[model samples]
Target: MRSGVSRRTFLASAAAGAGALAGLLPRPLRAQDKTVKIGFLAPLTGPVAAWGKPGLDGCQIWAEWINAGGGINIGGEPHRVEFVAYDDEDDPAKARTGATQLIRENDVKFVMMLGGNSWPGVQPVAERTGMLFSTLLPSDLSPSTATLIAPAEVHPIYNVTAVDWLAANRPELKTAVICAQDDALGLPSVATYLAAFEAAGIEMLDEPLLFDPATTDFAPVVTRMLSKKPQIVCLDTCYSDYVHPICEQLFQQGFKGQILSCTLDFYDQVIAKTSAEFMEGTLFQFPDFDDPALNADFINFQKPNEFFAEYNRRHPGQWGAVSWEYASVMDLWKAAVEKAGSAEPDAVKAAMTEGGEGLHAFGKARWWGKDLFGIDNALVGNWPVVAIEGGKARIKEFRSIPDWYDKHGELMKKHMAAYNQMWDQRG
Candidate 1:
């Protein structure tokens, strides 16, 4: 690993050259000596780029802010933060290469991943090196993977909160049909929604309809789902690429009912494709950072409204569910590094999960998920349930995830088992 501190003599050399010369240097100049590099391995190009690129933008803002504030103080010495990024393009082979390169060649203390299709490729390398890594997907956690953590977003597990909120508010919607692409993301979400619906007393019209990832024609999928005459159409964790096309087909077909999804990114575009009336009342997770609820005391992102503004200004119409997630993970990481007094991967990992507790973006949360994922690496707490009211995504409420888990955890485990999604069951 590269040394964080620059090799420049200060107090000793100055003392020898002239008495009391060291005190003359400006404070900022003396503090700007060391650099700490972190790795960002995620897709910058491809179907999932929306989930990856905006995160990079947010991290850039975070690094700049930390540096401006004289960097993070580590054992009384401040070190400038730097991010080294690689575009994995959502490919497993490329993910493996990127992970190895980031850890071996660049020597990053920690790596952040978008964590879906490419995680399997990166997992072995991460385990071999004992590199501290953060993923947005808690599904990626397992007991064997000690240094991996899902500190920010918990993905499909959080989808339950939305369903719980929906059942409470719109209890009349009974039957639902679901469809998703056959992949790492789609399957687990299908299981989660299945459990949520079952717990909510919403009956399924049919088994989950799995489509190929390369499928372009959503007409058949939409037609089949609508044929069941279900009141709710669940797009169980489909990619943004798939969500738009399926939603367009649903709108074009004029099969009107509630639409539930894990993310409705760039909903403005979807609203344009479909009518505002058609998009209204749609339920999903992930709130816009500028939402008034983000100002709540439980919220941790600094000036979330300003961050949202800057993101939109720089990368217009591109922010999505994962826009701020990577930066939030960075927030936890920075705090842990400072507390550990070192950036060594092991030390940081220990500090991060010091007491099986963490400051999740939403609020104070505990490390959980041993029953579902066979590991307690996920930070479980309150997650928001968002609905489109007048074509804008608004947080309806902050639902407690642990509370939901407490009520229906066994049902969730049964559904996950049906899908063979338990960590030990995974290869």
Candidate 2:
């Protein structure tokens, strides 16, 4: 408050209730003074349900927590938030339609999306409406586009940490082969993994086995990747919908070597399907909230362990890529909004930029990148390299991404070029 109100005092005001956002919400969702609406667009009924719905469910709990705590403060009042979810079903056209409905019909102020083609589909609507958009995939980022951001899961940039940790620790694991769907998120990740493997001096055996989204059976794909017999098999940003089948196939095929991927969700189910031993050496980017390493430096990681315990108690036996992701974005956004003392998209965006090297849930980090996603705005920094330990995923190390970019910047370019996915050609 320029009125001499302390930051804590202002937040305390917002924490007072939904009335904090009295003038902020769109006309429709605003009723009495007790509610604010947010849009959760994800692949709800599609093959990607494991990745999408469960994550939105996490958002439900986040909203509940905030509301229970009073609500979010915009300037000096409390606004309890509500999420209005729409299932885009992972289709670009459906994503566009869902976004339009969310803004025009539901009147949501902030729209959280699974953010791939869905991002591109919904961007125009966001631009026209001045809605703040958050995406998990930084591939949606561009300088011309002002609203979209990847604050939580910075996709491929974070993936580099996993491969780096693998190379240094498991030095004997030399050769690697990769497989992933050929799309905006998948292809960039594959390119990054190829570059990371090169930087780590881990030979990429095959030219990267890519599959189509229409592929429901992962057996053939797994068979082809295993044919390379590389010490490690990299699953490059595959949707959990695909990860499960591929992992099951890998287990069936008896792949005993190191397995590296961007995510491993519904891990208990995967263990039930593939058994505990085979899934033991798996390396991934996202980690469980219960990890002790998270307790050290992350602020928005507020009670991630508590969140995990609660989520397990309620939903039990289901978690996926998007889990904790959109919620993490909210945590970052809250800090930025508080820093700016406003919720206007441009104002908040400026505050995020001014913060300079903002620290996210993974600890201290900077937001810098243009060599890859064509926008330096995507938050880049230390990412934890998670590995399976005693049947539970744990952060083995937090690796430096800027260091990797320094060493193999051009290698990443070569791989991206090889796949013809230079972000310009992307939709």
* Candidate number of the best TM-score: 1
Candidate 1 off by > 4 Å? 1-32, 46-48
TM-score, structure 2 vs. true: 0.86
Q: lDDT per residue, candidate 2, 169-248, as tens digits?
A: 88999999999887777888988898888888899888888888667778889899899887898888876667778888
TM-score, structure 1 vs. true = 0.90
Residue range 389-426, candidate 1, lDDT tens digits: 99889999999998998999999989988998988888
Looking at candidate 1, what is the lDDT of residue 366? Answer: 91
RMSD of each: 9.4, 8.7
Where does the lowest 10-residue lDDT sum fall in candidate 2?
5-14
lDDT per model, in order? Answer: 0.80, 0.72
Clashes of 1: 0
